[model samples]
Target: MCIGIPGKIIALHPQQADCAWADVCGMRREVNIALIAEGDRQQLIGCWVLIHVGFALSKLDEQEAQETLAALHAMEEVEADVAMFLGAGEKR
Candidate 1:
């Protein structure tokens, strides 16, 4: 399934106008912001964005971002539980 992850804009890339650094769960990655770029890039710092395939799809409010992150974390836990169950079944 295709999923968009929420990330916070950390800083604007020095040489790339359409690219910026985003913090995704503690990891920083270069994300293309051309789709949502407007006005001053500095203003985007601290803003949350929905990212997909290295591109920032849209800007999200802090509350929405946090909710999405929480959902994603829940899904991760579910996946871990499923994996453990399957591993146990294989040992049977």
Candidate 2:
């Protein structure tokens, strides 16, 4: 399944007019915002966006972004548990 991670726009890219820097789960990444770049690009700062494959798919509200982040983190925990269980079985 393809997952779109939610991130907050921190700043616009210095050199790339169509790109911006986002803070995703505490990591900074440059994402293309051309798809969602509407009016003033500077206005996008501090806004939440759903990102997939280095592109901003759509803008999101703070509440929605928080909820999505929580869900993704929970999925990570579940995946880790499943991996541990499968690895244990292989040792038998």
Candidate 3:
């Protein structure tokens, strides 16, 4: 049930040794992106990436990320409705 949100890589620095600064909703945060390959670097910077457990799990295109987020949100809403409906039924 761990959730990973999308962020865009902004900068890379050797100081962190294996991490990069990524922006999520305009808030900058350092996330480990050492998994990316050199040739893929350009594609990543300014593009959405799926982050998890302090690391970048995978790169996500804009459309895919939006669809994923929408699906996750819908699942949450459906689960909540089911819980509420079952609880109310039990009270009747």
Candidate 4:
């Protein structure tokens, strides 16, 4: 399933209007921020953004970002457990 991940904007390429550098979890990468208006672009730096398919869909506050990240981490743990269980079943 496609999920919107929370990422923090770390840098901006003003020369390049559509994309900016973002820190998703611990990894930094370029994310398209074209969905947001040019006037608001300056506010994007150091802000939390909801990302999907390499694009920033929306901006979020710090609290919401933290909560979303925690939930995602929990989901990841559940997925890992399921994979381990399936692997063990296959070996059995």
Q: What TM-score would every model get versus the actual structure?
A: 0.83, 0.84, 0.62, 0.78
Among the numbered candidates, top TM-score falls to 2
| Number of the top lDDT candidate | 2
Write model 1 residue lDDT over 1-92, tens digit each, in one string. Answer: 57788889999999999999988777677889999999998999999999887899999999999998788776876677533322221111
TM-score-based ranking: 2, 1, 4, 3
Candidate 2: 10-residue stretch with minimal lDDT: 83-92
lDDT per model vs. reference: 0.82, 0.83, 0.66, 0.76
Is candidate 1 or 4 superior in TM-score? Answer: 1
Task: List, residue by residue over 1-92, the lDDT tens digit for candidate 4.
Answer: 56787888888876798899888766676789999646867788999999887789988999999998788777776677533322221111
Q: What digit string (tens of lDDT, one per residue) describes model 3 on residues 1-92?
A: 56676677777755765787777545576788877645645456777888776688888898987776566556656677533322221111
The CA root-mean-square deviation of candidate 2, after full C-alpha superposition on the true structure, stands at: 8.5
Better of 3 and 4 by lDDT: 4
| Runs with alpha carbons beyond 4 Å of true place in candidate 1 | 80-92
At residue 60, candidate 2 shows an lDDT of 100
Off by over 4 Å in 2: 80-92
* Residue 60 shift from truth in candidate 2, angstroms: 0.4
